[model samples]
Target: MKTELLEFENKHKLLEPTSTERVATLEAISEYTENFLGNIDTLPAFVNNVSEKAPFIQSINFEEQNTLNEVLKNIRLYIDTPGINPASGGHLGYIPGGGLFYGAVGDYLACITNRYAGVRFASPGAVLLEETVLNWMANLFGYSKNYGGTLTSGGSIANLTAIATARDAINLKAKDYHKAVIYTTQYAHHCLQKSIRILGMDDVQWREIECNNLYQMNVEELEKAINKDLNNGFLPWLLVASAGTTDVGAIDPLQQLSEISKKYNLWFHVDAAYGGFFILTNKGKQLLKGIEQADSIVADPHKGLFIPYGLGAVLIKNKKLLHKTHQYLANYMQDASTEKVDLSPADLSPELSRHFRALRLWLPLKIHGEKPFENYLNEKMQLATYCYQQLSNLPDVEVFNKPELSVFAFRFLHKELPLDKYNEKIQKAVMNDGRVFISSTRLNNCYVLRIAILSFRTHLSTIETALTVLDKSKKIAEDELYQELRNN
Candidate 1:
């Protein structure tokens, strides 16, 4: 038995590499990432039709040990090269956070230390760091010191946490779920709907308040809907507004919505996942004026702050309610109960074994300071305005929703082909061209292209390249349509 234990211990020692081995591994990884970043500008943002039978997938057996270089080579070929190169400045599709290098370094340090951030007693410093970060965000959004939040994996979970907190704060019974009313425009991020289903409140009345031409929630219609629900014996409960919507980057009239929520005795929750950190900028602060009135707000550092993905936040004005909703106790956690200097993240969020996510945001803010982040966000808004102007000036283009932040929709028109079909062909051409990536969404049942310019790496030059790509793609789509017509 002593001999067997020695053998197992020797084998386990392999997991902790020698100092030289660690240095070599780090150098190799650094080299690969340096080369990748050096050529990021020239890389294609989108790569279409990556095969499932690629070598990496075929050679997926993990039984055999592989060298570090070999693994990185496979990662470069199979993982990074095939999909949308989000690190590329040309990634204008869907909201993007340009994956800060400093943040990655912070992640490395956090993983190396393996500090448990979920409980205060486990690692008080880690917990305090997280608390400091959340407090900064809360103050940025104009919340009082009484506010509390937890860093989540991303906006989806943050929004989920907010919804759960709101539900519990109101003392909403499960039996009343059928008659409970929640209000938001159609443009609210779909995560809210998913949250409702996950919480088993699918029967709750989701009133999609009408939007004005600018895609903001029409407050008058919203009030009418609330009154209608009340008259019909429904309990109006929550109002979810968008600081920046997914499709067109529309900001609902937050100030108006807050007033209505207050007047109607509804819990006002703002889904500012895409636009919350924009509060750092002067313009954004002005635009997001009434956000302070929200009972709860969801923000993604991954989106607005240009941190790498996996850092999101939910700030609730009432800390006690947030704790009440998610707090749980187990016999194993009894050790942490005595150390109550501050509320642990595990008490306020559904997660108990959460990653040390605060380090990523903290390191960047400390290293670069807040000024650069603010400048980048402001630059994105300017670039969006420039792009919108350029697109509107084009002869055959129709720009939709002048970017409330840094995202908008547009469509290219062709006389011969149906508008939707023509735009679809143009989108395909753009993807195939692979110089810049843009996404498409349907608005009023019409296919339209979208550009979301939030990446810190994105600049005026990148947007100019996108415009050139659009022009080139338009010609390609037109020729393809003509060729098909002739063939038929």
Candidate 2:
């Protein structure tokens, strides 16, 4: 053997840090962790706006080493420091944006270990851990033995993957996917349209469902459209239902939709990214009654489970369908020595190198247990109802749809101003004040304000603060509206 080869083997003999250094490193990390977790309520004050006041940018500098103690002190300071929030202006408003204790630790350990969970043959242990989490998610939605799925980065990718699976399953028997159609509400998230575009099926018919007064997809409209499509020689490939809509927390009429899917032989998929995990709670389970009948589901632990983002899963009722659609062989990546090499993740997702994302969820569930997560979700449900009650009492505020889950949409009903003008003024006022962050949308050609109670930190007090701010904005907006009327 070459001397260089011998040197490489000798140098690869594990690079573990010394115990004395490890102890010091752990202590430093502990101190930083304490600081990070302690000050959750410390809201930031608006500092200099970068666009208004140009801030200095630092360039690459000379390398320097600090003592571990010094490094820890600086890290503590860095963790505590708050920068201008780009999402909500400079004011120090934050959503519960929860910090899961165990998940963080798991992420740190996974990073240190550098585990690749892409293939069963390369790392069976890592792959098994991920598969276990996927199985757990499948069971959560009442998926049976025939169902299986894969984890993705977030709800968008999960939706994309589910659509891809639907495409593959339908296209297996048919030649022209261009004639295939998808059904979803106009209020459905734009991610669905983006996914269709990505799949090179942009020209395919997208049936925009008509919503009732409550913002739910009208099941009758869906049936009518399905029949019309069939008569016109269009293939109804999928029916996408919303478990919890992004705008106003509107849940589509799932039971009726399920029946329609069964009658029409359409692939039924539920986008439960915001409300799926809440299936653990009584109210949530009740709200999502027909979700169990779905052929596929998209759920985000990041949003509903209160974990940090980068965790989403797609559960399909037919596991073999996923394998049938995505399985492909690569000779170089496979080991020929073993007669059977088990399944690889490359056989599932488009990615060849999957990260150890499962540990983030597994660690949290293991350490804190399921009871706490269930309780947390149940609390959010109550909070959303409380928000509705609070807004109902406000003078000019009109509650749009009573929360189907932890999301609600509403708008101000002004007697003297048109709906659009009043809503525009109100949105501007609330956003400019920077007291609370809320989003707005157009439902039925009318502007509607949307508040989704997603943050675990949101409480009755948060809702109360938002209402008080909304009251102030309403008065200001009313005055502005009257002034405009007078001026005109």
Candidate 3:
């Protein structure tokens, strides 16, 4: 039996590579990433060609050992060749956050260490570092040292956590769910509503407050709805606001909304996932006024901070409430139950085990400093203005409201055809052209092209490329759509 065990261990020895083999593997990976980065400026923002049938998928067998070279080749072919190139600066669609190289290095370090970041008892050093960053964010939002937050996978989970905390803080139970009232703008991110459903409060009343001409939440409509709910004997408990909505980048009248929430004793939560980091800019500070008043706020380091797309945060002014809402006890976790030092992340989030996400955010901030990030954010705002100005100058384009942050909607004006149909063709044309990527959304029942300029790598040149591509794609789409109409 001993000899058999020895043989089994020997058979799997390759899993623990020798020093030379480790170096070789690291070199191969570094080379591949270096090449990718070197050519990023030349890569298409979107690729239309998709081929699922490949011998490479069939050829690889996980049971057997594969060389690093083979794996990289497969990555280049099947993984890298098709779909959106998120790392490219030309990825203007949605809100693009550039994958900063320093962040990648931080992620690599995190993976290598494999620390248990969920609890301080397991890794005190890791927890301390995590708290440092979270504290930094808390301060940015005007939260004091007593305030705390949990670093989440993204805005969705952060939002869910915030909602759950709000639920428990209000002492809501299953029976009260039916009578509770929640308020949000129509343009609020769907994740907020989804969180309500997930928290088993779907029976609660929700008011989709109207928006103003700029698509910002109408404070009057929100106030009216709260009063109407009160008159109807429904308890209004929570109000959600968007700092920058996904569709039009509109900021809800936060100060006014905050006052309403306070007057009615409702929990104020801000989904600043897309625009929170903009607070670093002077203009942003003015635009996002009253964000400090939020009872809870969710921000995505990925969207605005230009980290990899995995870090989100939920800041609660009341740390005790956040802690009590998520902490759980079991026999196995007894060792991690000590209450000394900073509160464990496991006590503030749904996750009992989580990756060291702080490293990815911290490394970039430490290496690059806040000045560059602030400049990048301010640049995005400028680029949005520039794009809007250019689009307005065009003979066929119509601009939506001036951009409040780094996104806005516009579309080509078709005099004789269905508006959406022509815009759809143009959208396809732009996506197919594969030079610079942009997205579209329905606004006031019309399909409007959306330009989100958040990627840190996206500079004036990328915008120039987009304009040129838009011109060519517009012509192509017009001809194709007109020709189809004539034939039909």
Candidate 4:
């Protein structure tokens, strides 16, 4: 039996690579990534290579081993080359987060070390690193030392965890889920609503409060709704406000909403996934007043800090509530249990096994310090203002409202064509142009193009190029539509 086992082990020895193999693989990856970064500005922000005829093969087979070179080539051709190039600065459509090179370096080191960051007993340094990052965010938001939070995959997951904590803290079982109420504005990210349903509170009285012309939630409407809900014997347990909404970057009246939450005794959760870090600036601090008062807040380092697309954080003022909501107990985890060790990530998050996400964010925060990020955020806000101004000045263009942070919406007004179809045509045209990517959304039953300026690489030149592209794309769209109508 021993001899047979030895033979099997020998056959599978390829699983463990030698020093030479490791170096070669690392070198290849480094070269490929460096080249990709060097040429990122030249790449299209959005490209659709998969037509009906040539979709990606669904089956991923490891039946045959491929060389490193072949694998890298295939990755470049099939994966990175198609779809939205998120790393590109021209990605102004969604909240763009330019993947910082320092972040990439940190990711490399984290992956190589493979630290068990989920628990302190396994890797104290790694766990502390994560806690330190969370603490930094807490300090930014004015959360006290009594508070705790967790590093999550992104805004979606971060919101999920925070919602779950709120759910548990309320101590309402499934029976009460149907009667509970949640109040939020229309601009709140869909992820929050999804989290509500996922938590078995689908039947909760989810109210979409009215918004003003700028798309910010109306405080009067919110107060009336809450009071009405209370009068009607409904449980108004949660109040959600966006620091920077996704569509138009409209920040709800946080200070006003916080006061209402206090009066009604509700949990206030601020979704600052895109605009949280802006507090590093003086204007941002003024705009985000009362954010420190949130019971819990969600922020994405990816969007606000330009540290790639996978880091999100949640800060809760009540540490005990967060711990009670997420902490699990089992004999297997006895070794990790202690009053001292932590209160670590496993106790405060939904994840049992977590990637070393803190390193990626921490390295950049350390290398560049906070001043650069503050300046970058201020720059993005200025860029958004510039874009709004430029687009508004164009003939026959409609600007929605003044940008509150670093995003705004506008659409081309075509006299001859139906506005909806014309704007959709323009969206397609801009996407096809591939020089810059833009997205459109329906605002009050009207189609409008939305631009979120957050990419660190997006500078004055990028905005100028995008303005030119938009002009050309609109003309091309106009001609194409006019020709089609004439043919018809």
Residues 1-488 of candidate 1 have per-residue lDDT tens digits of: 99999999999998999999999999999999999999988989989868787765477687888899888998888888887988888999988766999899989999999999999989989999999899999999999998889999999999999999999998898999999999998889989999999999999999998899999999999999999998999999999999999999889999998999999999999999999988999999999999999999999999998889899999999999899998887898899877554689999999998899999999999999999999999999999999999999978888888998999999987776888878899989999999899989988788999999999999889999999999999989888988988999
Q: Which residue pairs does candidate 3 place in steric collision?
A: none
Q: Write the per-residue lDDT of candidate 3 for residues 1-488, one digit (tens) a residue.
A: 99999999998895788999989989999999999999999989999888868776767566776678998999998888788888888998888867999999989999999888999988988888899899889888888877769999999999999999998998999998988998997888999989988888899998999898999888888888988998989999999999999998899988988999899999999999999999999999999999999999999999999888899999998999998798788989878886734679998889988999999999999999989999999999999999899999988898887899999999998788777888888889988989888999999988999999999889999999999988888788889888999999
At residue 260, what lDDT does model 4 achieve?
Answer: 92
Error of 3 at 73 (Å): 1.2
In the predicted model 1, the residue pairs found to clash are: none
The TM-score of candidate 2 is: 0.85
lDDT of each: 0.92, 0.75, 0.90, 0.88
How does residue 404 of candidate 1 score in lDDT?
A: 83
Error of 4 at 14 (Å): 0.5
Q: How far in Å is the alpha carbon of 285 misplaced in model 3?
A: 0.8
Return the clash pairs for model 4, or none.
Answer: none
- List TM-scores for all candidates, in order: 0.98, 0.85, 0.98, 0.97
lDDT measured at residue 321 in model 2 versus the true structure, 0 to 100: 70
Model 2 residue 227 CA deviation in Å:
1.1
Question: Which pairs clash in the backbone of model 2?
Answer: 44-92
lDDT, candidate 4, residue 395?
89
lDDT of 4: 0.88
Residue-level lDDT of model 2, residues 347-458, one tens digit each, is 6666668778888889998888889888878877787788788887778777778877777778888776898888878776776665566667877678888777766666
Task: Rate residue 166 of model 3 by lDDT.
Answer: 90
